[model samples]
Target: MAMDFSNAALPAHYGLHFTPTFHSKIPPNIDPTSTTLPNPFIVVVTGAGKGLGYHISLAYASAGCSGLAISSRTSSDLDALASEISKIAEKRGTKIEVLKVVADVQSDSDVSNLEKEVRQKWGRVDVMIANAGVISKYVEAPSSSGSNLPRGIVQDADWARVLDINLNGVWRVSKAFVPLLSESKDGPQALISSCSMAAHSTISELTPIAYNVSKVAGMRLMECVANDHGEEGVQAFALHPGAVVTPQTKNHAGGQWSDILADDEGLAGAFCVWLTKEKREWLSGRYVSCNWNVKELEAKKDEIVKGNLLKYRMVV
Candidate 1:
């Protein structure tokens, strides 16, 4: 669990947060109905060995994305994913020029080389998904089965490692790919930051402090990319993929709550594909929840734009 706005002590800026007074939902002015996104998108998904990244790559493949590049630390995982995508392409009737790269997101040279591979092969990277991240190590197991759970105190190494892979890794990926994204001329281009709801709220007892803090900073990074490059026609978004079980969860031998409400990984992937579609400049530099009905958000577009909702700020 993440933060609770009503109870937890927050930053000074959050104290001035206020809900805007609005009469009704207004239609968004942008007419996306006519704008067509490029099929077979030129995509680069880091951390594509498994979990969310793998699903996202499959989503792109099924969507007829032609130029696809996936990176991972494990060559075997990448090999398997490449084979799967090939089968998908064979059946789906689209040519997928895919490349599986072995690169560590933590290394600058490794990330740079990954970007170079994509650019050298396809010329431009239309969508860059920064999905490489890590979770905290288990500090202690709960003693009782049905009693209240005590928060585990994180060690310094645990904190540092999580931040290194989850936060700095994302920065490395974006830095390597943004230039290629800016160079694209075909259709909409985006830098997708794989964020967590932990950024908004967390139960200190249940969540990793490092993971939560990194996501908060990650969201801010998306805003910086948007503000710095909006005029250059680059779109960026920090997305909260709903609670879904990952390999880490499986390894942790998850509790009863793991069986509770959770979204399929595919849902996040589909949302990402849709986000890269045309006329979505209004959403740049913002944080989005994948569970929100896209059409509903569209209907209130005017209100969202005018009110400047869905952002962290200092004043009303």
Candidate 2:
């Protein structure tokens, strides 16, 4: 998993674990906002064909969420995941409905279809997980590996596609689904997009310009949504899912960082669920790392707000 530099500022007794169990339950007294935040009733996870997104779907299912819709470009993976979730729901005695939609993040028509299907099926959305993203495939880039290219020479086509998918795709999900999210029951709805450790810092050895730039922009976009739409009952967050082993990480053209990457299958998935289920309004509009001890993070709320830590600012 990616290192938790945030830990450096915390007390050792907090027991911070970046790879902590993802499915950990939120204590009933987690925060004062717990009563206002209802259990995740309807959820939509993008890039859910395999890997982290699939695991996140399972987390919500096991929580007995009523509705789940997972989207991806691959049809077979979605089918298998739907079937697996069905079995899990049955075994867990959670009456969860699973909807699998084959949709590519880069395609406008595909996203529209996704929104349409979810609204038609469930009529409301509690959480929208924008987990679809990509790393650039620049073969001639130069980095620590000597094979990657420099920022100046990165191809235009590659940069455009990466930004379109990583950043623009997230906005697409919010725009298409925000209406449904606003209609959620209880106090507020949520938007949690999958970001990366690279969004905070890039590796000189294998810098992925497209992925890095797009992630930073997307993270900021989430904050903007939170700031501008607070009265509309909208809650947004940018999340770094830790360096989990996945197809994108294990074999990215930029070189694999999956070696020291987190090996836990459910960390990212479980953390996302916790963020939505618990009352952590203080962390809204912030970049949240799955590796950080959220309880410790809660304890640091005073310092975090006083210092304006997670938000983007020039320190003016």
Candidate 3:
């Protein structure tokens, strides 16, 4: 059935109501069967050279999946990560492949080359993670920054750079890989989105306007992709990885370790373990936090899906 959520109300904490049809009704902590884990799947992660991307790629590699790590400006870091994964895979006697590629997601030609390379190496890709992004600095121009910028204030090239990498880059990668994902006979492919809690909360102290806006747009992008391809087995999810200690967060904010541990560390770990579990079909197109609150969020799935579809039309 077509999912619809035209009249649902958002939770009080989010300040907006978004209810939808086609709820999963799955328990938050329910575990998937062993056969459902995406092992031996070929996965690709952008910005996988460092930070959260590095750790996430490692997690997948440790789980016995072949991973391709890409970066725009950090070939050395990407190489190191690939090498480390190779070592771990060899020690475990599990056949996991790690390929490191240097391509700027903002450049159409670069991303095109990346697609070509992956296709040549692997016939099909089962998973993709669009995780590359940036933040704003305080040393550039006002007009070049964004529409909300105030007069006489220098916003810096970093502002536009962030949007280019966070938004346009994602578009480039997803567009290039959709065909490959659709070719999979097992079913549609999966996309893991690195979204943020800032999108739902107004904690100005915790988030800057530019970062929040980009992340919100990112989550909606995943929803739209899911709506378009879910019928064919291509599913996407927007995930808030919580406060993992990454260079991106540390560059703009502080308290990396403390922020992550403030919540349940085991819960987050369990969620990661669940990510690769089989029966992931039950979790497709959902926005997941630390704990697998799929059922609670299902009530709003329809509205979220519709809003994302509308936003996609505007962009196109």
Give the number of the best model, judged by TM-score. Answer: 1
- Runs of candidate 1 with Cα error greater than 4 angstroms are 1-40, 143-157, 252-256, 314-316
Number of the top-ranking candidate, with lDDT as the measure = 1
Please give, for residues 178-290, the per-residue lDDT of candidate 2 as tens digits: 77777774734889988865554553234457777888898799899888776678889988776667776665433344344544667676677678874466777888877
The local lDDT score (0 to 100) that residue 211 gets in candidate 1 is 76
**Model 1 Cα RMSD, 1 decimal:** 6.1
Global CA lDDT computed for model 3: 0.60
Residue 92, candidate 3: C-alpha displacement in angstroms: 1.6
Candidate 2 is scored at a TM of: 0.82
lDDT of 1 by residue, 1-316 (tens): 4422331354433311222221111113212222233764688999899998998888787777777899999999999999999998898666888898999998999999998889888888789999988777654554333212334443423777778888899999988888888888666779999987655545543445777788888999999999998887888899876556777444433344444225676767777777786648888898876655677667767877897766767655
Q: Which stretches of candidate 2 lie over 4 Å from their true place?
A: 1-40, 138-152, 155-157, 202-205, 252-258
Candidate 2, which ten residues in sequence have the lowest lDDT sum? 28-37
Locate the minimum summed-lDDT window of 10 residues in model 3: 1-10
Model-by-model lDDT, in order? 0.73, 0.72, 0.60
lDDT of 3 by residue, 1-316 (tens): 1112121322333322222222122234533212133554777888777666776676566556654545545889887887888886786677776666888888999888878887888878777777787655533332322222222213333456767888888888889887888786473387777776546643332444566667788878877787797777777777766555456644332223243323332233234445534435555666666433545455555655566321323323
Pairs of colliding residues, candidate 2: 1-261, 1-262, 18-291, 141-148, 141-149, 142-148, 142-149, 144-205
